[model samples]
Target: MAPHLGDWRGRYRGAAIAVVRPASTAEVAAVVRACAEAGVPMVPQGGNTSLCGAATPGPDALSVVISLSRLKRVRAIDAANNTITAEAGCVLQTLQEAAAQAGRLFPLSLAAEGSCQIGGNLSTNAGGVQVLRYGNARELTLGLEVVLASGEVWDGLRGLRKDNTGYDLKHLFIGAEGTLGIITAAVLKLFPLPRATATAWLAIASPAVAVRLLGDLQASFGSLLTACELISDLALGLVRKHLPGSSPTLSPSSWHLLIEVSGGDDAQAGQQALEAFLAEALENGTVNDAVLAQSNEQARRLWALRENIGEAQKIEGLSIKHDVSVPISRIAEFVERADRQLAQAFPDIRIVTFGHIGDGNLHYNQSKAEAGDNAAFIAAQSAVNRIVHDLVHQLGGSISAEHGIGQLKREELLRYKSPVEIEMMRAIKRTFDPQGLMNPGKLL
Candidate 1:
């Protein structure tokens, strides 16, 4: 077994026959081929930052972990084509900086960008803060180079904007979560870097008000409104308690919105536009108290408050987490209904809600107020999930938003997905991995 497998959360531990670090695509293929011949299952892992436990394998499972960290490299950059081809193990932040150095922007800015690898991002089809302007990892990817379960490398690394070729094979592996193939390298689309930026922190009366304000801001700023995140009072409290130097932005409120607008090099003009929009929003009762960031450092501090939510929650205690998404218009109703039902069932529960509201996704997590009884609260996860997921399904929302269905949500996927859809996914799995030796017992 592998001597050491770094567990990101220390929640799941796995042992493998061996950990193989392949320096190149050919070496990765050879390792897979050898495993295939030996009838051994294989788990392809990158930065090992998966929150869904997708990268963690069971101790009893006979498998080999293929670590792609050694394959880190920036293969090619095409400024004319506005694309960069990078190997699987390239850190997301490094790729972003590389794009910036080339006078372009790769706008997949996640909280874990510093440690997460591009391969894991593509495998999970990660969504980040900028998803409101730029789409998820799938949308940013123009092409991919994957090593299949059968040791076959499919090189569809074309940097074309419009490729109407027979079948778009790249899409199959982007969000496959390592079930179909191992993403070795990819060609990702890049955009012109924004020169000017404006950010605001607004206090809202409720989630409904936040949703209405979002619509107003979108109508006014249009494409310039890059991000609009919603945070609840409970969520902010955790940050204030756990995160150092974190203070409330405005009067304590039920909800807060972190809005940002960016475009060409005219910081003054951007700030004026944002100020004008916020002024009108306040007058129209769309927002209550708002603070516009005067400088980049202030803007970053405000963002730190939003980004440190998960970390703070982890420090607090064990909690039940739900990463869900619904239609933008239905977000207000979803939050209201979910909170009402959960409160009714578990009256003593303390709910902390926040996330990318512009993208209609929320991290609706709950923890016991008294830390000593966390075990009892965690033991009710299945029931809590049912209550939340059922409401999400009723609202035409997804049970899992950015976090893919790993072993954590496999049964939930079956419960939520249509039989026909599940059957089709199974068929695809059989087609690509007939022996089910690639990341077996995951995402099915």
Candidate 2:
């Protein structure tokens, strides 16, 4: 429990009877069955990298943590079907590399890809920057191999794209956060590897302008617009301050956009189209300033700025964080309203806002400029959450976006979810896990 009990944020610690390492599907089933017979609750753990304490056991000290790290394996790769079957413990980055090795692309990407596990990714339905083009972990997944709470192995790992045979059971497990069953393996969708990729850093005026630029890019480039990340000046300042040797990607502006476009199998294809668009965009006054990467090295540096925001925030101080999403058309409104509301309540509240704006998700977090005051500011988390989440609700947005409703958001979920929807979810939980043995005190 020393390693698995704590989440990536180090904000949660759990007490479990023991942590069990299961190497195979049979072993996982056996362990689950034993726990079932003993009437002991079981927590299915992956890489222990969840932001919401999903994999961490409760403080009861009565549950067993089933660590799936030992089950790392690429079970099979069907490039013809554009799918790959991987075990629960396979690291997300390893799966991405494996897909590239097979001349395909597995587009489930995030900063934690190197440490996060496939099962957990699917379980949480993680959405990264590429979700603008591809989709969330749930969309990339085709089928699943789950260990039911009864200890029965359900092998539904079929790579068929048009399986409307019945209810999409895989979805029940994906994004379920292990409340229903354990995701042992999955058949994940893949795409043709991009031959040419272009990356650019743009100085934007505001969130509204970013949205306009996004629409323009999508209109011209279509689905080739792979990623569009939004970073406020405050967020970028944090990156520059904490990440040594990191320089600004463009002239300092109120906001910066890290954009990328990818096209099919032409190593030299991306630069020209992006260059043309930027030329037109500049002439029309959609963007303030821009720097198109001349080389992959430059591109990586530009990307590092966006990827390192979370780390920079950690180096600064504790913060109240909210991963919320609104409709793409209303993203600017959400940001404007939320920022104004927060500022009115907490003067000089340093706000760090950035995310996959193309997909309508924002990592909106707040802290004080001073490290000591930030600690006290952190105590107003509930108050901060109420303001942010209330506005998100007003905008028809979700309180929890990419992150799952783990123990952290159970109360929030109950508060926001409609009574009928909550009842249906609870009924499903009862049907799937009547004993409440699987990941107790989570999600529901």
Candidate 3:
């Protein structure tokens, strides 16, 4: 209970009377039933790696924490079906490895994949770099096995890809953040393993150029463009400073794009295509400078530059973080306008910006430029949030893109969502958990 009381960010501390580890869905249902019958609240926890405190119990000590770690297992893999059934406690990286072992690809990826659980990934509908090619968790999931509030296990672990049944019940629980039920197991969609891959690091002029390059690459490469990330110069500097051996492959510039293309066919042709496209981009001044990875090791190093942004920022200092998105067409406008607006509002603030721009998501963070106590500056979170979120809203964007509306963004959800939409969500919550025992104080 003590260990399960805190979230990954240490931003939330909770209290639970007991932390129960269930080995199977039946055991989970039994525990849930007993807790509900005893009038005790419950919080379903996965890897405890949630950034928004979704897995952490509330401050009240009345709830019981149900840890799904003991249920880890890869139930089945149907390569022909292109789906894998995994238990709730399966670590995301292990699933990815299992898919690779079976010569397939499970593409729900992020920094926390090493520690985050499959259930949490589905629960949050997490988005990642490959979202440009492979959709988010919700799209990749084919079926779900969940335990309802009353301990009834809804065995939805079907691998059929074209089951146009009545209502899609899996969706209600996938992104519900445990507000509806406990996600016990899931059947996730997988793709053919990429046999050939090419990666590049490019220095670009601005966000507008990055957007133009993205459109051009999409037009040229189509589905081969698996990932396209945008990084600011300051974000790269933080990586170089905090992560040893993290050197830029390309010359320093104001902004950078870490682009990748993958194909299951010939490696040489894929490499040639990517290089030819880059040559054209460079010739047209669309790319100021670029470096292409000649080997797998170099590709990994190039990816580390983009993948290490979160950890780099963490080492730098406490910062206000926003996982947001706008329409792809409006991404450049959003960045330019948000930068100007935030610069005017908070002078001398270090803005660390980077994310999967291929899909219009951005991990925009801010902190005091100088390394000192930012407690006072952190106190202005609401102001900072209002400025950023308001702009996102006006541009028809989402405040929480990959991360769900856990306890961290509940208030923001209320502010951004319409009354009718909020009411619909509340109605669904009531229909699913009438007793309100499932993950209280989350999402809603």
Candidate 4:
């Protein structure tokens, strides 16, 4: 119960009347019905790996938490249709392994895939390294099975490529963060397993250079360019400092790029294509220095540097973290201006920046240089957020990019979104959950 009441970051702790684990969709429906009849608020939880505290119940209200861990199952796999029907509690890694076994690919990947649930992925519309080629969770999902506010189960699990239906209702629940309903199951899209993959670590001059290189890679490889991640030198240094051996062995530069190209033909062809591109870029000074992985183990090592940024930061100490996204064209400007402004506002603040640059998302985080001053720096998070989020808003960006607006960004959403937009969201919230008993104090 205690574990279920807290979030992954430990930033939020909540109180729940009881945490109930329902083994099946019918059991989940029964729990919902009971909660509804008793006029008790309900919080639907999965994996509990949400960075934004979306799944945790409010400390003020003694609500009933419905943990979906017991509902883990791989319902079916339609290889011909390129879809997988999985229960809510199924771990993301399990689905990926299941897909691999069937000669298919489930590409919704993140650092937390080992522990995060598919239902939570759908709820947050998670974006990961592969999003450059495979889009986010919302685009990958075809259908969902949800338990309505009244305990009625809505099994809209249809695996169709194209449907000219009036309204795509599944989307309403996808990124709603359980404010609308509980996602009991989902029908997710799959791709053909790639025969070969090429991973590389590049030393870049700046974010602008990384963005330009990204355009070049996309033009050359097209859809084969699977991932493009940008990491500041400071960020990579943290990984090297805290998580030794995971950092890539490459010439250090101000900025680094981790790129992967996969699919089409055999391993030799993929490797050749990527090598050719890198050689040309290196000759032209587009890439300062680069290291192309020769084996699968090497590729995984390169990815570990990018994946371990968050954990490394955690190991370092408490920091102000912001998951933001601007247009591909404005990302460089956003980073530059925000960095300068934040530096001026808070002296001695160590900024560790990195993220999926291919999709315009950047995890811009800040902390004090000295561990003793971190507590004081964290107390000024609001000022730091204002500097970062204001720039994001001015550049026509999102403050909460891949991570959905849970309790953490609920207020920020209102500040950035228009009145009409906020009103419309509230209207939908009222429609799906009139009593505001469904994951209250989240999203809208």
**Highest-lDDT candidate:** 4
Worst lDDT 10-window in candidate 2: 244-253
Q: Which stretches of candidate 3 lie over 4 Å from their true place?
A: 371-373
Number of backbone-clashing residue pairs for each candidate, in the order shown: 0, 0, 0, 0
Note the Cα lDDT for every prediction shown: 0.89, 0.91, 0.91, 0.92
- Poorest stretch of ten by lDDT in candidate 3: 368-377
Off by over 4 Å in 1: 1-7, 246-248
| Candidate order (lDDT) | 4, 3, 2, 1
lDDT of 3 by residue, 172-270 (tens): 998899889999999999999999999999999888999999999999999989999999999999999999785656766899999999985899999
**Candidate 4 wrong stretches, greater than 4 Å:** none
> For residues 210-249, what per-residue lDDT tens digits would candidate 4 score against the true structure?
9999999999999999999999999989988988995566
- Candidate 2 positional error at 122, Å: 0.4
TM-score (all chains, Cα) for each model: 0.98, 0.98, 0.98, 0.99
- Those runs of model 2 whose alpha carbons end farther than 4 Å from true positions after fitting are none
Comparison by TM-score, 1 against 4, better one = 4
| Backbone clashes in model 2, listed as residue pairs | none
lDDT of 2 at 307: 86
Consecutive 10-residue window with the lowest summed lDDT within model 1: 1-10
